[model samples]
Target: MTFLKKHKNDILLILAVLILAGGFWLYSSFAMDKGGEAVISVDGKELCRLPLGVDTTYTIGEGEHFNSLVISGGEAWMADASCPDHICVNSGKVSLEGQSIVCLPNKTIVSIVGGEDSGLDGVAG
Candidate 1:
């Protein structure tokens, strides 16, 4: 068509952008460790590790400062907590290495890690 011929360069640019975006999305999704585990910790001490691929619920902390963690559908989140701010409960589910839900009040931290994460003793930045 004459219209396409006149705007062929613009069309090619848009197509290129779409292709690049699609590739990036695919790469990021695949890079995540889907079978990783969620490491729960309280007061700087490790508590437990639950696999993300399995559905389970766990309690952390003690007494009035309890936090309820739920892992389902390959994601982990804090479903309930007694912390005043409830920030941990508000944190959305995570399913990727290094992603975490933290409860400062309860000194609880739930992080998605390991299984297939890229090798690193640790890294900053």
Candidate 2:
């Protein structure tokens, strides 16, 4: 009882932080519009938009430089790539709007689009 009284403020602060964190988690989980299509681009040029509902594999570029993108179960990911680091392939799948997988070496970018706009165009530092 004495310990509880002594740490009352600390306990209250912890509880407040936990509550705020939980509220933010719930809002992030439930809010935001899910994307319906995955847009692929190379060298800052738009390539094509694939429907998320369709399960398929798309090969971007040709010759020694290529990236294989797989879309399945409403998610998109890089299945294979010719890039040396293979960071894009290891980045895993993305299903939410504004999420992207980029390969700097291959100059390839796969991003989710066709969702609600956040109304922000570039953040200034």
Candidate 3:
């Protein structure tokens, strides 16, 4: 009982911080706008833009270098790739603006773009 009284202010501060953290987590998780398109790029060049509403598979590059992108159910993911690491294939789907999957070996990037304004000037790491 004496300890509680002595540390009352500290306990209150901790609770306040936890509550704020939880609120921010909820907002960041649920407030994102669904992306409109998935922009495919290779070697810093724009290749194509696929709509998120359409379910399709696109093959990027040719010959020995290739990456397969699949879009379905309003999300885009790397279906397959010729890259040995296959990190992009395991990166999972992206359905929010500014999210991306990069295949360093293939020099390919798949990024989500064209979502509603998120009311933020920019995001810093």
Q: What is the Cα-based lDDT of residue 13 in candidate 1?
A: 100
RMSD of each: 9.2, 9.2, 8.7
Candidate 1 C-alpha lDDT tens digits along 62-98? 6888999998877888999999999999998887776
Clashes of each: 0, 0, 0
Model 3: per-residue lDDT, tens digit, 36-85? 88999999999988888778999999889999999988889999999999
- Worst 10-residue lDDT window for candidate 2 reads 116-125
Clashing pairs in 1: none
Which candidate order results from sorting by TM-score in descending order?
3, 2, 1
Q: How well does model 1 score by local distance difference test?
A: 0.83
Clashing pairs in model 3, backbone N/Cα/C closer than 3 A: none
The Cα RMSD of model 3 versus the native structure comes to: 8.7
**How many backbone collisions does model 1 have?**
0
Instruction: Pull out the clashing pairs in model 2.
Output: none
